[model samples]
Target chain A: MLQTDSLKFSYPKGQTFGFPNIGCKAEETLLILGNSGTGKTTFLNLIALLLRPSSGELIINNTQTASLSEKQITEFRAQNIGIVFQKPYFVNALNVSENLLLANYLGNNALDKGKAAELANSLGFEHLLSKKVQELSGGEQQRVCIARALMNTPKVILADEPTSALDDENCEKVADLLEKQSKIIGAALIVVTHDHRLKSRFNNQITL
Target chain B: MLIKIVWKNIWAKKLNSFLCILLMMFGISIISLLINIGNQMQDKFSKNISGIDMVVGAKGSPLQLILSGVYQIDAPTGNIPMSELQSLQTNPLVKQVLPLSMGDNYQGFRIVGTTYPYLKHFEADYAVGVVFKNNMEVVLGATVARKLNLKLNESFASSHGFEKEGEAHGDKKYKVVGILKSNNSVIDNLILCDLKSIWEIHEHEEEHANETPEKHTEHANEATEEDFDITCALVKFRSPMGLMTIPRLINQNTKMQAALPAIEINRLFELMGIGIDAFKALALAIMLISGISVFVTLYNALKERKYEMALMLSMGGKRTKLFFILMFEGLFLSLSGYILGVLLSRIGLWIASRMLDQNFNFDLQQSMLQKEEIYLLIAALLVGIFAAVIPSLGIYRINISKTLAND
Candidate 1:
C-alpha cells in the first residue's frame, strides 16, 4: 500500500508549486487527470518514489521515503516500484528480451525465463523480444516497455501517458493489457494522463 | 552485459572511434620506431666495441676518440708516437693489439688503415673475395660495396681526409680485393687496408705524419715501422689486468690516454637516457590527454542521457550499475586504442627497418610487447576511469521523479 501526506514538489527553475498536496493508496486505481502543464506527471512521480518531495512525506508500503538515505531510497525503488514512460524509452541497442533482462539486473534477481516467456506470450510480445526497440512501431515499443515494467512483478505500476501515441484499437489493447496485468499481479495502478478516452477503464480518479 | 553495450555503442560510432584510434596509432608508431632504432644503435655500438678493452689515442674528448676509433665516425683525437704505443703493448699484462690509422675517405666511407689483427678482431668473413694482401689492396664493407656497385678486382682512388671533394689521392688507386659479409656493425660501413698504406700515402706531408721525418719518407714504399704514428691502438689484455692495469700504465707513462669503450659508451647512453625518458613522459602526457577526452565525451553523453538513465533507474536499475556502464564506455575506448596503437607501432618498425637495411645493414627487430607497455595500457585504462569519474557521479544526482516529470 502507498500513501502521501501534503506531498509538495517543484521544478528547481519554476516559479509555481507542482502540486499543493497529493496522495494515493494501493488496491485502487488512481487516475490523475490534468492538462499538459498541470503537474499530473509530477504527482505520479512522487507516488512512485522516483522523485523526492520538496516538502512533505511519501509513505510507500509503509516506509517513509523522505527520511531514507539515497542508498536506501534506491533499494526501496528497485524492490517496490515500476514505471512506464509516455514516449516508451528503451536502450535502442538492446533487444526486447535484453531490455526485460535489465530489470532483473537492476533488481539483482534471478531471471525466471519461463515466467517471462509466459508473460510475453500473454501480452503478444513473445515474438518481439528478439527484435530491437527501434525496429518496433510505437505500439509495439510501448508494449515492450509495459512488459519490461512488469518483469519483476512489483507492488505498484506507474504509467506516464501509456496510450498517447496509439489509435483507438491499439489504445484499447494497451489499456486492457496494463489494467488486466496490474490487477492480476495485485499491484496498485496509477496512470498520469489528460486523455479523457482512458478515464472509463479505471475505477478511481484523482483530478490535479 | 555492460561491456557488451559499451562495445556496441563504440561500434555504432565507428568513425569517431577510428579517428581516435588513428591518432593513437600515429603517436605510437613514431614512438615505437624511434625506440627500436635507439635500441639497435645501442646494440650495434656495444657489439662492435666488445672486442676492444680500451682505446689508446691522442689526448682529446673521450667520446670523439671512441667515435673515431671504435665507431669509425668523427675525426681522430690525434696520433701518439709508435714508441708510446709500443710501451703500452709490451706491458706484462698485454694480450694482443690492433693499431688503427684513419685519415682518408673513400666516398664518405672511412678508409681505416690497420693490420690483419684488426680484421681478425671483427671476425670478418668474405662474402665475395679474400682479405687484402698487398699495400694497394683494400677490403670493402657490404654497404660500401653495395652502394658503389664495386665488385671483386675493381679499383677506386681514395680521397684525402674525410671530405668528398678534398684533394684526391688519385695516384694511389687501391684494388678492391675483398667484400666483407653483412656484419651489422660499424665495420659494415668502413674500408680497411694495412696501416702501411696510410703511412705511404701521407709520407710527403709531415703535418699529417706523427713519426720521425727521416723515417717517415724512408718507409714510404715499404711501410716501415716508423712510417706511421699510431692513430689509435685497441688493447686487449690476456686476463682482466687491462681493466685495471692498462689504463693506469697508459695514463702514468705516455702522452696517450686509454679510454674504456664500455664505460664511455655507458656514459653516452646515460646522457641520451635523460632525453629519451623526457620523450616517454611527453608521450604519456599525450595519452593522458586523449584518455581524458574520451572520458569527458562519454561523461557529457551520460549527462545528456539523464532522462534515459532515470527511466532505467525507476525501472529498478541500481545507481551503481548505471555508473559502471558509463565507466565501461571509457575503458572500452582506451583498450581498443591501446591495441591499435601497439599494432601500428610494430608495422612502423618493420617498414623503417626495411628502409634502413639498405645503408646500415642492420636488420633491427622491434622488441615485442614490453611489460612497460602493459603498464602504460593499464595506466591509460585507469586514466579513462579517472576521466569518467566526475561524469559518472552525475548518475547519482539525477532526480528520477524530476526526470520523469520533465519527460
Candidate 2:
C-alpha cells in the first residue's frame, strides 16, 4: 500500500503546492485529475521521490520516506516504485527491448531478458522489441512505456498523463492494460492526468 | 550493460567520433615519425663522429666537409695535397692524422683509400684474412661484404665516381684481402685501401690505354710527393690545445679548411631543429583541436540528451556512473587513435628507411616505441579526460523532475 499525509512542496520564488492526503491499497487503482498549473506533475514527483517535499509524511510498504537518506531514497524508489511519464521518452540510442532492460539495470535487479521479452509480448510490442523507440507510433510507445515501468515489478506504479495524447480506442486499451498489469503485479496503481475519460473508469479519484 | 550503452551512444554519432579520432591520429603520427628519423640520424652522426676532433678538407662548406669527411655522406670538397697533413703529424697538439681519399665506388658503396690508422680509429676488427698490404688490394667493410657478397681473395673493379653507373676502372681490379667485422659506424659502408691506390687509379684513368704490364708495376712503386693527394683528413687532438688552435690556424693560414665535428654536427641539428619545432607545434595544435572537437561533441550531446540523462537519474542511475560512461567514450576514441597513429608512424619510418637506403645507402634502424611517444600516450589520455570530464559534469546538474515534467 502507498499513502501520503500533509504533503506540501514549495518551489523557490514560486507557488507552494499543498497536496491532499490519500491512500490506495495494493492491487487497487487511484486516478488524480487536474488542469494545467494545478501541480499534478509536482505531486507525482514527490510521490516518485524525485524531488524533496517541503513537508510530508510519505509511506510505501510501511516505511516512512522522509527519514530516508538521499541514496536510500533512490534505492527505495528503484526497488519499490515504477513511474511512467506522460511523454514517451527513452534512451533513444537503445532499442525497445534494451529500454525495458534499462529499468532492471537501474533498479539493481538481475538482468532478465526473459522478463523483458515477456513484458513486450504481453504489451503487444514483441515484434517491435529490436526496433528503436522513436520508430514506434504514439500508442505503441505508450504501451512500451508501460512495459518499461512494469519491468522491475515494484510495489507501487505511478503514471503521469498516461493517456493524454491517445485517441478513444488507444485510451481504453491503455487504461485496461495499465489496470490489468498493475493488478497482476499487485501494486498500488496511481494515475495522474487531466484526461477526463479516465474518471468514470477508476473507482477512487482525486482532483487538485 | 554499461559497456553496451556506451558503445551504442558512441556509434549513434559516427561522424563526430571519426573526426576526433582522425585528428588525434594525424597529430600522433607526425610526432612519432619525426622522433624516429631524428633519433636515428643523431645516432648515426654521433657514432661516426666519435674519436674525431677536426676534419681538414679542401676549402668548401664546413658542413659539407664534416658530412664528406666524417659521415661520408656528401661529395668531397676537392682534393688537398697529402703534404698539407705532414706538418700536423709532427705537431705535438695532434694525436693522429688519418688521411682519406675517395673518388670511386664499387657498385653503390664508396671506395675509401686510407691507412691502417682509420681502421684502428673505428676499432674495426678483421673478420677474415688480413688487412690490405698491396696497393691495389682492399679490405671490405662489414656491410659492404655482406651486401656485395665479396669474399677474401675476390677481385672487383672500381667505378670512376660515386654512382654505381660510373665508368668502370676495369683494368686495375681491387683484390679483397680482408673483411671487417660489424662495427656499426660509417666505416661499415666503405671499401678500404691505401692512399697511393686512389692516386694511381686516377692517374691511370687520365693517361689510359696502351699501358704495358711493366709500367703498371712501375707506377705502383713510383708514387712521388706531387702525386700524393687526399680528399680530406680526420684529425684527433692529443690535447685540448689542438682544438683551441688548429681549426682557426688551418682556416686562416692555408688552402685547407678545418671543421670541428662536434660544432658542425650541433649546428646541423640546430638547423634541423627549426623545421622539427615547427612541425611539433603543428602536431600539438592538431591534438589540441582534437581535444576541442571531443569537448564540443560531448557538450552538444549532453545538451541534447539532458532528458535521457534526467530520465536515467529518476530510474536510480548514479550521476557518477553516467559521467564515467562518457569518459569511457573519450578514452576509447583517443586510445584507438593513438594505437593506429603509432602503427602509421612505423609504416612511415619503414618507407623512409627504404628511400634513404636507396639514395644515401644508409638505413635507419629504430626501436618499436620511443621514450617521447610514451609521453605522447599520456598527453593523449589527458586530452581525453579534460575533454570528457568538462561535459560529463553536466550530468550532475540535471534537474530530474523538472526535465521529465517539462519534456
Leading candidate by TM-score: 2
DockQ of each: 0.41, 0.82
Task: State TM-scores per candidate.
Answer: 0.70, 0.95
In candidate 1, what are the lDDT values of residues A5-40, reduced to their tens digit? 777777668645546444455556778888877777
True contacts kept of 2: 0.71
**Each candidate's lDDT (Cα)?**
0.77, 0.91
Best by DockQ: 2
Lowest lDDT 10-residue stretch of candidate 2 chain B = B218-227
Off by more than 4 A, model 1: A1-28, A35-39, A53-69, A111-120, A125-130, B43-68, B72-97, B101-232, B235-289, B370-375
Residue range with the least summed lDDT across 10 consecutive positions in model 1 chain A: A15-24
Clashing pairs in 1: A50-B401
Cα lDDT, model 1, residue B61? 88
Candidate 2 local lDDT, B1-407, one digit each (tens): 99999889889899999999999999999999999899889988998999899999999899999998988899999988888888888999999999999989999899999999899989989999898887898999898999899989989999988999999998898999999998789988999999888887877775676467765554456547544678999999999999999889999998999999999999999999999999999999998899999899999999999999988888888888889988998888888889888998898889998899889879877567899999999999999999999999988888999899984
| Candidate 1 global TM-score | 0.70
| CAPRI-style class, candidate 1 | acceptable
